[model samples]
Target: MPTVAQIEQALFQLAPKDLAFDWDNVGHLEGSPDQEVQRVLVALDVTENVVSEAEKLGCQLIVSHHPLMNVRWHQAEMQTLRPDRYLGRLLRRLVKADISVISMHTNLDIAPGGVNDALAEALRIEDPGPMPGDETGLCRVGRLRNPVKLSDFAGEVCKALHANGVRYAGDRPVEYIAVGGGACGDEIDAVIAAGCDTFVTSDLTYHQFLDAAPKGINLIDAGHFPTEDPVCAKIVAYLEKEFPQLIIIKSTSHKEVIQYFVEGE
Candidate 1:
C-alpha cells in the first residue's frame, strides 16, 4: 500500500495547489501525510452524503473537486450560511472515522491535460489548444473539426457524460465550439477569439447568453455536477496507475443540487 504522503505527492504533481488562486483552498485538508492509504474515494463535491458513502465503502481518503477548505473560517457558529459548516461537519465525521480529505479544483483545472482537457476529450472537440494568459496553463482553446447540430451536440454531451440534461444557446449546426469543464462564463472573449461559434460549460447567466448570441456564438448550460462529475473517474484512474495497491473508489453519492422536475400538480 502506498503511504498517504506518496499518493498525495503524485496528485499534487498532477495538480499543484499553487496553480490555483490564492483564495481557492485545495490539496490535502485533513489527516497526516504519513498515514497509510487503505482505500480512496473520489467525488465532485465533498458532502455529508459523500462522507457517509465513503465510510460505508471503507474508503479512508476522499479526493474531491471542490475544497471543503475554501475560504477562511473566523466563525465557529456552525450556521448553515457558514462557508464550511456543513462540509466541516462531514470532515469532522471523517476525522472521527479516520478518513482524510483532499481536493483538486482550480489547481486541477490549471494542470496540464487537466479538467478542461478531460472535458475536451469527452466532448470530442478537435484541434485542442491551451487557453491564453494561462501562465499556470488551465482552460484550452479547441474546435470541433466536424460540425454537430446544436441539439445533437447537447444530446451527445448527455450520452457521453450520462448527464440528466443539458441546456444551450444558439441554433443548429455548431461549426466551431468551445468547452470549459465547469462554469466558465468569463471566457467569452477567448472563445470568440479561438473562433468557436459555440461554447459548452456549466452555469450561464441569461444576459451573458443573450450577449453571446449577438456575437454568433452558442452557449450551453450543462449542469455543474454533470459536467464535472465524470472527471472523478479520471482522478481514480490516475491514482490506480500511480499506486496500484491504493484502492480508489468512485463516490456513490449522486448529490445533485438541482432537481430536474418540479412537484407534480
Candidate 2:
C-alpha cells in the first residue's frame, strides 16, 4: 500500500503543481499525507454522490479533476464553516469517512499526455500537437485520417464522447480539428491559426458559434462532462501503473448530470 504523500508525489510528477494556474487549486486538498491508501477512486468531480461511492467502496483516496473545496461568491454567505451547509456537509462526511482527495485541474489540462492528449485519443485524431500560440498546451490540434462532412463529424463527436446531446455550427468538410476539453470555447482564434477546419469543445456561446461559422471553422459543443470524462479513465490507468499493488476504481456514481429532452420522442 502506498501512502497518500507517495501518490501525490507521483501525480505531481505527471502534472506538476507549479504548472497549475494562479487561481486554480491542484494536488492534495484534504486528509493526512502519511495515511496509507490501498484503494483509490477516480472521478471528474467530487460531488456528494461520488464521496458516498468512495465510502461504500471503502476507498481511502479520491482523485478528481475539479477541486472539492472551492469557494464561490454566492456560496460565501452560506456559512461554509458550519457542518450543515452544502460544502460543509461534504467536508465533514469526507473527514468522517477518512477519504483523502487530490485534484488535477488546469495543470492536468496543460501537462503532456494529460487531458488534451486523452481528448485527442478519444476523437481518434492523428499526430496531435499543441494548439497554435498556446505555450501552455491547453488545447490540441490534429487531423482525422480521412476527411468527413461537418455533419458527420458532429455525429462522431457525440458518439465518441458518449454525449447525450451535441450542438454544432458550420456546413463544410472537416479533417483538421482542434479540441480543448471543458469550457474552452473561446480558443477559436488559436484553433484557426493551427489550420484546423473544426473545433470540438464545450460551453460555446450562441454568438461564438455565429462568429466561427462564416470563418469556415465548424464548432461542436459536446457538453463539458462528455468532453472531460475521457481523462478520468486515463487517470485510473496511470495510477494503476504507478501503484500496481493497490486497487483502483473509477467512480460509478459519476455521470453527466444534464439530459436533453426532445419533443414527441
Off by over 4 Å in 2: 71-79
Model 2 CA lDDT for position 84: 65
Write one digit per residue (lDDT tens) for candidate 2, span 31-72. Answer: 999999999999999999999999999999999998876544
What is the per-residue lDDT of model 1 for residues 1-265, given as tens digits with 9 covering 90 to 100? Answer: 6766777789998988678877787877788777788899898887788888988988878888987665554234434443356655665687788888888888887676678778878888787777655444656766677887888888888788767777777864786666677878888777777677878788888898778667878888777877777678789899998988878888777555776653572
TM-score of each: 0.88, 0.95
Cα-based RMSD of candidate 1 = 3.2
RMSD of each: 3.2, 1.6
Which residue pairs overlap in candidate 2's backbone? none
In candidate 1, position 107 carries an lDDT of: 85
Residue pairs clashing in model 1 are 167-221
